[model samples]
Target: MGGRDVATASIWDAAHRRTTVGLLTLVTLVAFEAMAVGTAMPRAVAELDGVAWYAWTFSAFLVTSVVGMVVGGEVGDRRPPGPGVLAGVVVFAAGLVVAGLAQHMAVLVLGRAVQGLGAGVVIVLLYVVAGQAYDSRLRPSLFGAFAAGWVLPALLGPLAAGLLTTHVGWRAVFLGLVPLVAAGLVLLLTGAPGGTPPADAAPWRSRAGWALLAGAGIAALQYAAQRLDLAAAGIAVLGAAALAAGLRRLLPRGTVRARRGIPAVVASRGLLAGAFFGMDALLPFVLTEQHGWSAATAGLPLTAGAVGWVVAAQLQGRRPDVPRQRVLRLGALVLTVGVAATATVAVPALGGWPAYLTWGLAGVGMGLGMPSVGVLLLDQSPEAERGANSAALQISDATASAICVGLSGVLVAGAADAGGPLWPAVLAAVAVLTVPALLTARVAGRTVAPAADPSCATNLGR
Candidate 1:
């Protein structure tokens, strides 16, 4: 046990310390931005008189992020992750600056789109770096640390952003991240490798074109979801078809079908993200409007969940003897239970505090399952394919979460008009999403692949 403890502690040793810290810091910055934006956005929209376009603010970011992920994946496959990370940081900072100075909501949305692109690139590159730089034994710990990095941001980002928006201005939230992005760039460049892979025979332009189509289709679908007319329904159907076609070409061939092996892993990621994030986006609104809580108070459940996520991730990382697939299955089950428990908060008799506990439970499930998916993807992919596959994993997650959130918005809006509790609609949407997650969990357990590295094979031998 002592020897094992020493081995785990070595992730922060001189040989690995720089890259680990750089990556963790990068993740922390992203987490802070995401949480802070959520807190600040309501004020920003009100100030800009863009209440009608509220949903588009988030949808724009998510849709454009697909384009960024595809481009980053191709870049990482053909070159080192360092260059892509640097480019992403620069672009992300530029977006932050644009957003900070924006006087209109349209400009703010465009700025967010740019930020999403940069974020997509940065996240994919980070995954590639993990695949290329870290040994298999260290991957779990690295992923766990990544989750842990979110802890502080999740705890403080909302309260801080609320304070800033209340006293200073919402623009400060966007502007403040610029310096952090610069620092992250320096750290990433210093720690990450600077080598290029052999060029691919396939043309990246074609893949990029498909990614654009996917993004457009997703955006259209989100727009359509906001309307209730038959015309909007027709548009949504057309958008879904386009999205499916583009994804078929972009992801692994079997991804939509959830074929065993890497495809199942990717599908599971989508299901998990859709189920969790869709509900997460609505929780604050539900708490504030229905339960009459302040934004800071509503955000407390999110903080609790972040803490739970890190704890579970740490526990999973320490137990490498367990199968990654088994962890995924167990996590999915736990998440289902948590989601179900959270729905009870909608009952007037139960009140809202139960959400703090249940959402944390949901976070624990995510911590257990989410990192394991990354490990499984790395385990299954060849070194040459890591970048592309990592992009697929992220694309799946982004697309699913976007669609589910859009649908939830429609449902909640309709419920609000019907003069009923909106929380049940949000909870129902989340509950429905869990079906795919639960089904995919079993499929994920059935598919196994050889380890990416020989040294790590024993750890994944199960």
Candidate 2:
């Protein structure tokens, strides 16, 4: 159907209402979990006495999620997406149980790994659902709904998590969501249409093996970063080699090199994620440790950032005529400024108050740029390659974020050992990490093909 013809139909119309609600519920819950974790993690780490392994909590989840994404993509292609999505829900809920009941940092990390697996499967399968069940015209709207799913979570998740952690303990943050997941699962089973499975199953063994290797590599790197011994060197080398090998198979050809078109889009996504989330995961820690703020108070800045992200994304959505590449570049620029400004919080005299505003600016950058990458990825990918590419986009995002977080963790540990000002080290790390955002801005133009339609790029993958 033409765009104008389909404009009259709403995603909330009778045909799509049930499935839409179900999908949005799942998306919101997942978003809430992600947002809540950052707020709860600082307290959780301190209580477990696993302060040394703080980065591992995030890295493990991100690294393990690569395995889940690969599996979800393979399953979605070969069989019914419902079963895989259901399995994801079960696994995710189980992880929450494990994390909530944890006694030590190791157990918490393990639970996080489990959560990663479920999150990966659920996320990829959700994309599959959108593609198979919804009309092409309705997909833009569906994706818009997906963006909307993050709104409430962004607004309230950090604050809610902080309050829970301060009053009820961090375990409550994890356990509290179990019932909501069950509700979302019921919604999906009842409302979502099950499309016909592929006639023949494609072999996924090779991809799965690579994903495992990559996950292992990421975990090893995170572990090694915390250790000061010589053995850490060998481990780091081995991990890098494995990560490189795995990425070669998992990503589109030349993605690491940032070859133009889809490859550049994929690469840009990784760089943007690495630069943004690498710091985001640490902001709460920065606030609590350096500023002497309560967990709830520390989370308010994150809330500000989320609000900015949503607002900028809404503005981007309204201006369909704006070229995506331009928006992507502009977002990168704004994000770069935000990251730089945010680093000043590490300075004792500046105070943490500025971060709330600066991080919000960074969020606006992400809002404008991140969604643009998703739209471009879909526009550029062939239909047959869409599922795989979608998985690649996710893998890229997670991999980069894990690496950045681990690097930050190392700096954090160093600052503790030095016993000087922690903010100075944080500032240096932010300076180094902000390079990726600058790089992303430089390559943003290559994300679009020379002859592509900018209007069509406004649809899908968000």
Candidate 3:
């Protein structure tokens, strides 16, 4: 299961057309749900008046999803991943239906929690499918395409969600998913038959322990967010204990510190994702509270970012033969520029378009770097532990983003509650984001080297 067992490759795999299609469909569903919720949640919360627990809805899903990822990774390594994926999709669709019919905030939260579980399973399962089905040569392109699949949601999520929420009611947002999820399920099941033999052995990842860790960690995080109380200390302690038990036994050594090639890629992704999305989670509040914009208007910059992501992804796909490390470095440099540009909005002489520009560039940066990072990990990740490695990747993102965004929320909430200047609060959020973006850029410059194919897996000895 160690990364040493995996081999690297170059070029694209032409034979996996059906498998690739299946993977793409899964990615599309993920994008759809993400964007759809971004649009509809505001209305859902307003109607339910569950603003008090706003962050929990997301936090709950994220925390459980992390565990699901870990568990899925282990399961994926040892058996047929298709059944797990099918179960996940069904649960997710059921959650959506329940959410659409929710009559109370509590019920809605419960549905969201179920949805979170399904999402986590599906997310890791997609990685498993990619790892198991695609040759090393073709993975980068696939990852790039995966990132591209999200573009539709980015382009239309907010606008569509707004319309649905405003006119059709947010309930329609959840209900609308029925057709898409159903279609994706059918496609995944029928699009590709068994392409590979099942694993000959069982993976060692413990399901019960992983569930405990994810549940405890996220529950603690959410509880901490609800009230900065002394009890947070106890909950945090419990979460830490659970996470350690689950992850310490599973992930590669030095993963938290990015010690070597694979760990470095995974660690860098976690930090990078945390910083970017943390900033993202805050930028909207700044627009709405400080600049006096509408929810729809606040979403425009994000939509622009989505556009940038799509463009970059498509370009990357077209040039699948490009050097990977170079591409990664360039992507990192773009991220630095994008993040730095956020501060431009603070400049008095500039108009609000500065912020929009920043997000757009950041999106492009993400499309280039995110897939590259994932592909690089896949390069080094041992085949048997595909789910484990993928879980590590997502947990890194979830853990980091959750903490960063949660911290920003606390800072912003505290400031607003104290009647502090809104711009200053926004700046505080922006400042934290800049740190990781710059650091990641430095890492990319120091670490990445040109490769024959940006999409394949390779391990340069650290």
Per-prediction TM-score: 0.89, 0.83, 0.84
Local accuracy by lDDT, each model: 0.81, 0.83, 0.72
Q: In terms of TM-score, how similar is model 1 to the real structure?
A: 0.89
- The CA lDDT at 165 in model 2 is 93
Candidate 1 lDDT by residue in tens digits, 200-266: 4245554777787888788889889777678998889888988988898789878777777788889
lDDT of 3 by residue, 1-462 (tens): 234422333223334565666677767766777777866887888988888767666666666676677667766777677888888888788888888999877888878878877888888888877776666656777887888776776676767788888998999888888788777767666654454434554436376466657566756765676566688667767766766676665466777665656666777787678777887887777777766779778878887887888788767755655655567767877877887778665544454667888899998888888888877777766667677778778877777777787778877877888886766766777777777766666565323323423333345432
Over 92-184, each residue of candidate 2 has an lDDT whose tens digit, in order, gives 999999999999999999999999999988888887777766654455446556766876787878779989999999999999999999998
Residue 240 alpha-carbon offset, candidate 2, angstroms: 2.0
Residue 47 lDDT, candidate 3, scale 0-100: 88
The list of candidate 3 runs beyond 4 A from truth reads 1-17, 41-56, 166-169, 193-203, 226-250, 423-425, 445-462
CA lDDT of 348 in candidate 3? 42
Alpha carbon lDDT of residue 306, candidate 1?
A: 82
